[model samples]
Target chain A: MNLLQKFCTRINLTKSSKGYNVSVIALLIILLLIGIFLSISIGSSKISLADIVSAIRLKDQGSNNYRIISFVRIPRTIAAVLVGCALAVSGAILQSVLNNSLASPNVIGVNSGAGLFFILTAAFFPVNIYLSTIAAFIGAILAVFLVYFIARKTGASRMAIVLSGVAVSSFIGAITDTVLTLKPDTMIARAAFLIGGFSGITMDKLSFAGVFILIALIASLVLSYDMNVLALGDESAKSLGLNISRIRFSSLILAAILAGSAISFAGHIGFVGLIVPHVARFIVGHDNRLVIPVSALMGSIFTLLCDLLARVLFAPYEIPVGIIMSFLGGPFFIYLLVKGRRGQLYD
Target chain B: MIKLEDISSGYNKITIIKDINISFNQGTITSIIGKNGCGKTTLLRTASNLLKPFSGKISVADKPITDYSDKELARKVSFLPQLRSVPNITVYNLVMHGRYPYLGFSRTPQKHDKEIVDRAIEEMNLASYVNKNIQELSGGQRQKVYIAMVLAQNSDIIFLDEPTTYLDINHQLEILQIVKRLKQMGKTIIMVLHDLSNALSYSDNICLMEKGQIAIYDSPEGVYKSGKIEEIFNVCSQQLAVADGTKQYVFYIE
Candidate 1:
C-alpha cells in the first residue's frame, strides 16, 4: 500500500512538473545542447567530443577535421537550430493570434510564399543573398496579410483562416509550378530547395536569416505578455487596455519575418513550425510567456535531431530534412486530430 | 459618472441604437432592461465605449473618452460583454490579467497586483480554486471568476451586459448581492438585465428601452410607478412588500 502511494505520488509529481515553465525550459535547453553536440560530432567522418573541444581550442586552420567542423558541420548545425527556433516561434504566434491549433507557417502558406519569392528573386535578380532574403520576407508578409484579410473579410471564424490559407496555398502552388516548369534552369538545386536540406548551407547564407530570426525571436518574447492578453479574445483584450489591432498586426508581422527568414535558407521546411508549438503547448499549457521560449527551445532540439537523422540515416546519401519531418509529423498530427475529436486537443 | 450624448452606433455601417442620450450617476447601480432587439446591449456597449459611436460624444469622469488613451480609459472604466471566450487558463492567471491596464510593458504582475487579485478571488469565494483550470469550473463558478476578474480591475465604473444571464436562481441572487456590494464600495455599476424582478428590486435606477431609444430612465420606483415597464414589456407587474421591509416586484403576462 505504501509503495502504491509512492508510485501515485511520483506520477502526480511528473504531471505537475510538466506544467512548470522553468523546469521544462531547462530540460529542453539541456536537450538542445546535447543535440547540437551530437549533430557536430556524429558525421560520416566521426569526430569525437574531445576532438571538437580541441578543434575549438587549437584553432587549427590546416587540419582536415578542423576544416570539416568549421566549413561544413558547424554551419549545418547552426542552420538547423536557427530554422527550428524561427519556425517554432512563428507557429506559436500564429496559433495564438488566429486562435486555431491548426494554424502554422507552412499550413497557412507562409513557407511556400517565401519559397516562391526566393525562386523568383533567383530567376529575375542576380541571385544576391540579401535580396533573396528580403524578397522571401516580403512574400511571407504578403501571404499572411492575404490570408488574414480574407479570413477577416469573411467574418473571421475558427476555421475560416485555415480554409482561406488552403485556398491561397494551392493558388500559390500553381504559380510556383508554372514558374519552375517555364524556367527549368532558373534554380539549379530545385529539389533540394523544395525539400529543404542543409547540405550546402554556409556561414554566408546563414548570416542574414540568422540575424533576422534572432531579432524576431526577441520581439516575440517582448510582446509575449500582450499576446497572452490578446488570446483572451478581442473584446476582452480591448477591455483590458490592449490595443487589439496593433498587437495582432505586430504578431503577424513578427511571424512573417521569422518564417520568411527561415525559408530563405532552409527552403520549404514543413511540420517543424506546425508540430513544435503543439508540443510546447502540451508541455507548458497555454501561456505565451512560457510557450514562446519553450517552443523556440524545443524547435531547435527537434530540427537538430531531424537534420542529424537526415545526414546519417542512409549514410553517404542524404534525404531532405523536410521528408523526415513529414514522415514523423503527418502521423503525429493525425493523432492530435483524432484525440481532439472529444475536445481534448483544444480548450 | 458616464454620459452619452446623441450616440448612434452599430456594426459596420448600419446603426442599431440611434440618438441615445443617458447618464449613469456615480456610486449607483443602473440596470438597462428591455426585450430582444430593443438596443439595450447596444446602449450598454456604446456607453462603455466598446462600440465606437458613429456620431456623438461619450464622457467618463467629465473627460471625453477619446481624450484618454486606451489604458487610461481602462483604468477608469471596465466593461464585461455578454459573450466571452473560455480560454484555457488558471483562475489566478485569469484574474491577474485584470491588471493589464496597470501593468508595465513587461506585464509582470507586481506584489500589489497579486494582492488585489487575491482579494477579488476571496470576495468571489474562489480562494480554493485559484490553481484550478477555469475550464474545470461550472457555469456559475465561471461567471463568478469573470466577475472576480472585473473586480480585480478595480475600476471606478463597471459595465456588465446581462451579468445574470444563464445563471441559476441562487447564483443570480449571489451575483446581484456582489453587485450591491460593489455599489456600496462607491463604484458606479451599469448592467443590462433580463430578469425584470431582479432588476427592479436591486437597481437604484432602471433605463427602460423600446425600439432603438430609451423609453424612460428614472428611479426604479418612479419607472415602476410610471407604468412604462408594464407597457413596454407587455406584462402586468405587482409590487409586494417582503418580510424584510423591502419591496419585491413580480411580473406576469395579463
Candidate 2:
C-alpha cells in the first residue's frame, strides 16, 4: 500500500473512525475524476481532452465543442456526480440511523415519495423547477416520517423499518400511478422525471440542488460520531448521552433533504443510494465518518460510469440512467435482502 | 447524589418500575438487587435519565435531572446498559466514544480527552487489547471495555447494569473491587446486580427489590435483619461472619 493507503488505515484515538484512511477515499476520488472526464469527453459528439479543456476554460466560446461541453456534457456530468453523492450519503445515514443495511431511500419509499410529489407538482403547478424541488423535499420527508411512524407503532424493530418502507413505497406508487392516469397531459412533461436521467439537465437546476446536497453532506460528516454511537442500539446510545429520538429525527430530515434534492434534480434515481453506500462500506468499513465521504465519492464514480454506459452504449438511443441503475441495482438489492436476512451484511 | 421521587418508569407507555422514591447517597456503592424482571434495570435507567419516569421527578446534585442538558447530565452521570449491540470497532474507538458528550460540534476529542481514554483503558487492564477489534475479545473482556467506557466518561455518578454478569468469579470480584476504588475516589456508583451474594458483600447499601417496588433499603446486615429478604426471595437467611469480621448473609430458598 502507498502512503495514502497507509494513511487511510491509520487509527485515530479521538474519534470513532479509524482515521481518514485515504487509500479507498483517494482511489474513489481519482475514480470519480476519471469518470467525470470520461462522461464529458466520450459522449456521442466526442470532444478531445484539449478541446474539452479549452471549452471548459471558455477559450473556445460558442464553438461546437464549447456548446457540447457547456450545454450538454458539463451539466449532465455535474448532475450525475452531485445526484450520486446526495443519494449515497443520505442512504448511509439512514442505514446507520435505523441500524439496517436495507435502509436506503429507494428501499424505504423516499424515492417513491419524492417521485409522487414531483408528479403532483408537474400536474398542478406550471413546469417550475423550484416548486418541484420543494414538493419533492416535502414528499421525501413525509414518506420518511410515515415509515418511521409505522415502524415505531409496530415495535420499531429493525425489520419493522424495512417492512413499513415497502408498504409506504407501494402505497405511494399507487398514488403516483393514479395521478398520472388522471392527468395524461402532465405525463409528457414528466416522462423523463419518472424514470431518472441526467440527459437535458441544466446548470441552473444542478447548482440549486447541488448547494443543498453539499450542505447535507457536510452535516452528515459532522454528525457521523453520533451516528456511530447510534449504531450501538438505542439503550446503550441513550445511556451514553445521545438523545436517540432527536438524532433519529434530525438524521431523517437530513436524509430526506438529500434524497429529495437528488430526485428533484435527477428524477427519482434508484439503487445508486443503496448500492454505492454498500460498496463504500466494503472498502471503508462501517464507520460513518469514512463511509459518508467514501460513499459520496463512490456514488459519484459509480453513477458517472453508469451514465456513460447509458448515454453512449447504444449510439444515440439513450436510456435513462435510472433504468440502468435499476437493472444493476435490482439484483444487488435482492442479494442484499437475501444476504442481510441470513446475517451476512453489517447492520 | 441522585434522588428519584415517585418514579414510575418503563417502556412504550407501560410502567415496569412504579412509584420509586429513593436517593442514592453520594460517594458510595449502592446495588439494587432483585430477581428477573423485577425492574432493577429499569430503575437504574430511570435514575440515570435513560428512561423517563412516567410520573415523578429526578434530581441529581440537588437539581432536576431533566433541567440539565443531556450533555450536562452526561458529564455528571454515566450509565452502562446491560444489552448493547457490539459494533465491529476497536477497544480504543469504543472507549473514545465516551468523550462524545464533552466533544463540540466538530465531535473530535482533544489531546486531554485522549489522555482520559488512555487512562480508562489502563484502569480497565485493557492496555494490550486497546488496538484489537471488539469481536476479538472474550465476553468478559468486552464487558470490561464497556465498563471502561463508562469510567472514561469520568462522571460523578456511574450506573452499571449487571457489570459482573458475564465475568468469571475472579473477574467479578475484581470489578466489585474496582467499585471500591471508585467509591474511595468520591464517585457515587449505582449498579443492578442479580447476584445477591456479591451485592451483599460489595455494596455499601443494598436496595432489596420485589416486583417493581423497593422492599427495603439498608446495609447488608440491616436488610437481613429487616426479614424482607426471607419474604421477598422465599429464602431463610442466617448471618455469618467472614474472616474480615463483616457479616455475610447465607440464604437458602425453601
Candidate 3:
C-alpha cells in the first residue's frame, strides 16, 4: 500500500489502504450515467428506455427515435461531458500552480483571450471552425503569458496576479467588442461567443474538441504528482529539486488548451472551471491525482445535468446551458469566498 | 562536505552576496549569524542550489552543484525555506512529499517510504498530530512539521533558513535542541540564525556576516575572541557556564 492510501485508510476504515476511496468516484460515474440515460430518453421527443435499448441493440433499424438519438442528443450530451471535463481539470491545475483558489481560465483571461482571437478568425475566415479553434489555442497561450508577464514584474504577489488577470481580461473584452461593433456581419461568431449553448452540435465539432480535451485530460493526469508538490509553495518545491518554472509553464499550457477548446466550441462558459475543482477538492481531500480525475468526472456529470435542466425547464423554449451554469456557479462561487474565511471549500 | 568557492548570488542580475568562499565540514552544525539583510539567507539558499550564483561555483562532495538534476540534488541535500504558507494538507501528506525524489508519477509510497515518514514524524515528536491539518497546529508545531518533512527526505545535508524565527522562547530552545540532535545523528547542518546565544551554544561553527560578506568564520570561541561580534551586533556580550558544561552567551544592548 502507498502512503497516501494509508492516510486515506484512516477515513475509510472498512477499505484497505491499497484502494483510496474510489466508491465516491463510482457514485459520480453512476450519477453521470443516469443523467446521460435521462438526457437521451426524455428530451423534446420522449423516447423510452426500451427504444434506447433496442436502438443500442440495433434491432430497430427503421426507427425515427434511433435517428434522433444517434445524431442529435448523443452529440449534444457528449459535448457537455467534454466541456465539463476540460474546464474542471484545467481549473484544478491552475489553482494549484498559481497557488490561488480563484485562478481559473475564465478568471485569468484565458477564455476571453480565446474568445477575442476566435472572433477575429471568424471575421477573417467565415464559418471555419478549425481556424477558429487554432486561433483560440494561440490566443489562450498569449493571454497566459500576458498574465505571467505582469506578475513576474512585481514579484508575483497573489493579489497582484489577480489584478493582472482583471487587466488582461478587460483588455481582451474591449478588443472583442470593438471588433464586433466595427463589423456587424460577424454575428455568426458573436452568436457563438455571446450565448454559450449546445443547441446544434454536429459529429465533426464534437470530435474536434473531444480529441483535444481527451489529450489534455490524460496529460494532466500524468502531471498530477508535480501539481501536488506545487501546493507546498514554489520555494519549498524548488528546494526539493523540482523545476518550478518548467512545471508552472507546462501546466499552464495544458490548462489553456483545455479552456481554449471549451470556449472555442461553447461561448464563454463562466463557472464550470471555477467551481468544479473546489467541489472535487472538498470530496477527495487535496490529492491532485484524485482531485484532477474527480473534478473531471464531477464536472462532466454536473454540466450534463445542468444542460438537461436548461433544455427541459420550459418545453419548446430552451434557455442556454451557460445561463443555468452561471445561475448555479455564481452563487456557489460567492459562497465559497464567504466560507473561505471560515476555512471551508478552498485549498 | 559542501564547498562554496567565492560564490555570488542574488535576483534579477543584482548581486546580494559577492565573492563568498567557504567549505562546510561534514557532520557539523554551522549557524550563520548576521544583521538583517546581510545575505545570510541568500548564501544558504545559493549553497543548496536554490538560487543560482552570479559568479563562482559550489560543489558538494567533489561534484559541481550544477551537475546534479533536481531529483539527484534532492537526494543529496534537503532545504527548508522560510515558512510562509501552512499548506492546507495533513502532516502525513506533507511528510510524504519528501519522497518525491524516489517516487515519480503514479507510484504511491510503499512500505519503505511510509516507515521513513513515520520515523521523521516521530523524531520531530509530531506523531500525535500526524493526521492534523498543518493550519490547525501551533506555530512551533507547524515548524516541526516542516522539519519532519526534510528529515523524511533523508539527505546527507540539510539547509534551514531562519528555522526558529517567530517562535516563542521555549519553542526556539526546543528547535535548536532538535538541530543539535540532528547534528549528533551525523547530518551536515547549515542554517541562518538570528539568535546569537543559540548559535554560540548549539553550533560547532559560526559564520558571521557584515554588509553581504563573511566577516568572521570560525569556531564559537574563536569568533567570540575576535572582538568583532560586539561591533557588528552593537551589543555587549557576556559568557556564562550553565548547569551543563556548555557556555552560554548573553547579549545586552549597550
Best by lDDT: 1
Q: After superposition, how far is residue B59 of candidate 3 from its true place, in Å?
A: 0.5
Task: List the per-model TM-score of the A chain.
Answer: 0.87, 0.85, 0.87
Off by over 4 Å in 1: A1-19, A126-131, A145-171, A186-190, A332-344
In model 3 chain A, where is the ten-residue run with the lowest total lDDT? Answer: A12-21
lDDT tens digits, residue span A150-205, model 1:
87786554467778888888888788888888888755645656777788889988
In model 3, what is the error at residue A292, expressed in angstroms? 1.0
Candidate lDDT values, in order? 0.85, 0.82, 0.84
DockQ of model 3 vs. true complex: 0.70
Ranked by lDDT, top first: 1, 3, 2
Ranking by TM-score: 1, 3, 2
Every model's DockQ: 0.82, 0.67, 0.70
Query: Which 10-residue window in model 2 chain A sums to the lowest lDDT?
Result: A11-20
Compute the lDDT of residue A78 as modeled in candidate 3. Answer: 88
Over the stretch A165-229, how does candidate 2's per-residue lDDT look in tens digits? Answer: 89999999999889989998778656777777887788887787788888988888888889999
The residue pairs in collision within model 2 are A8-A21, A8-A22
